[model samples]
Target: MPLSPAFSSILEKEYEINFTQCLPSGRLKYTELCNLLQLTAATHADLGGISFTDMQEFNQAWVLSRMRIEIKALPQWKDIVTVKTWINTLENSRSIRALEIYLNGEKIIGGETFWAVFNTVKRRPEALALGHKHFELYPDLKATKESFSKIIINPEKEEVFEKKVILSDLDIINHVNHVKYLEWCMDVVDEKIILNQKIKSFEMNFMKELSLRDQVVIHENLSDNSIVFSITKENKNCFALQLNLV
Candidate 1:
């Protein structure tokens, strides 16, 4: 079957869920799903000529500002799945990208992300377009169902846990991997809360990067049907996350 035009300029890649990427239950882990999404995003950007290497000429690099994902089911170990991604829109400094995971031709996971180009030297966000160099490669695609705005929630004052960064948490970029932030949030959340509810959606924002020297304080609030996590290091907010469950 053919996909809709709104998902055009889409880059599709196949991946096998390896044993290492799965949990003890033989299901694909959430962190591994996040890794797949990161890889897919990079590949799509490369195909669009907006890859990290391509942006280097302009002293810029892409950074994920916010991302939201919804998982319907997780593929088991050794399952072959396809990851599809495309650019949704580009406006000034920010662009929206959507990704979906399909197993046996059935959609299982879907997500949307907001990204911005960072000026390496200035240490600030740079407009995605410089003069005529706009990233409108797939401007007509409309893959996301939600707006690209940041998620907002009020966190409780007390912290659930304080975690020290270990070497395993760092990625090639020298800072803790964005996926690790989500893992940390999950670690501090009550197991009963997780097992009792079905996670419908996830939203996270990266405010600041955390490194090996940083000690993170995690705060969590469990409402009736939602959970919010806030991470801070040295009194500065690093990440804010929300999980909606049914």
Candidate 2:
């Protein structure tokens, strides 16, 4: 696909929050908020001629490596929110992108994402085959106050639950969707915290991809202000999530 005439380095798109995307409190669910940000980033890439369809021609696709999200507020059901996204850096097989969500012209959430180009057929990381120089980069512009960080897994973490990857967990890439990992960890969290909007920020790191029928165990490490969850398969770490409570 060619770059759209309306293409811009930074893109903003509006979404109407529906009841299905909200929590019992009518505020948007964290997973749904991530979906909106992902959608906006995809839209921007599509318009810039570097979308999944464009990269698929060369057996390549972008995969999330790490993500950091800071939230001041969550939109409620029936609210109209705008998501803005832009590339902070792009080189070789890796890129950094920033995204933000605004309600009534006030920014409420910001996200920093690290992505890597992967060979879908070969199932390995590789440099992107498509040209991306046409899209301007903003190395100095950042959406979140903090950049991406490594989420340290505690060796003393206790196993909380186990799950098998199912059809619902897979995305277009045939692996577990990144957001599903967050949902899994959230399930074990206190409902009162989520219902009362007590989450201030969170981070997720994807270490290995999980496929259908793959069984995994989730572990938890609790602290005074943060809770860390690590998922493992056959004693090997696959993913980690750290939730910073307000």
Candidate 3:
């Protein structure tokens, strides 16, 4: 596995899981799990921002297209586990992001993901040529056509909520981690609704950078039992997420 130009640095974390599906006596909180995932995501993404050539006018962001997570074990609340992830490669312009979860140095679960890069102003995938200048900084990553786009659902009107960027979310990279954003947005979701039904799949799109003092407005849209969660910064759509809950 050779690295890609987009795969600039390594992102790793220690995650403790204290809940799972096996227990029914007490209770389970999906918000907690969603928060953990966001933390893990933030760990990996903060690493991606490192090799940037210029940050003044131009910045790059990743939106997840598809994900495959195979769990060999589940950790309860407060249990500490470790997570490691990176840009495995680039399929055309799409980046393949992968993660591994470990407990006491033993492999527990693994995750694989796909992503696309969006140019902030244009609000779309940045052309390879347009990004070539910064690409030079990541001479190792390759540009490709295989980068698949994440699925998204738009609604006529969205249910909105506001959240603050608290101190607990700062990663080693001086910004909010990826999983933190997910957890923040998912926190308001009614668990009875998410757990009662089965989710077929999910997609996450990261559009902007979040740091201290940032206030995010989370927007959720539900249709026929399916749902999409979009987070905004000062009104610009940053993350467009979709879930299939049946």
Per TM-score, the best of the predicted structures is: 2
Worst 10 residues of 3 by lDDT: 129-138
Model 1, range 1-246, lDDT digits (tens) per residue? 122233326689999999999766777777788899999998766666667777777777778889988877888899999998877777677878888999999988888888887776676887864332433456555444564556564745568899899999987555687899999887766665454436767898999877786888988877898888888988878898888887
**Estimated TM-score for each candidate:** 0.84, 0.99, 0.52
lDDT of every model, 2 decimals: 0.78, 0.93, 0.56
For model 2, residues 139-161, the per-residue Cα lDDT tens digits are 99999998877798999999999
What is the Cα-based TM-score of model 2? 0.99
* Residue lDDT tens for model 3, 136-211: 2232332221233455646564757787887888754456656666666566666665444344344466666677
Model 2 residue 61 lDDT?
A: 90
Q: Give me the candidate number with maximum lDDT.
A: 2
Which ten contiguous residues of candidate 2 have the minimum total lDDT?
Answer: 33-42
Q: Cα RMSD (Å) per model? A: 4.8, 0.7, 8.3
Superposed Cα deviation of residue 31, candidate 3 (Å): 7.0
Regions of candidate 2 where Cα sits further than 4 Å from its true position: none
**167 in model 2: Cα distance from truth in Å?**
1.0
From the highest TM-score down, the ranking of the candidates is: 2, 1, 3
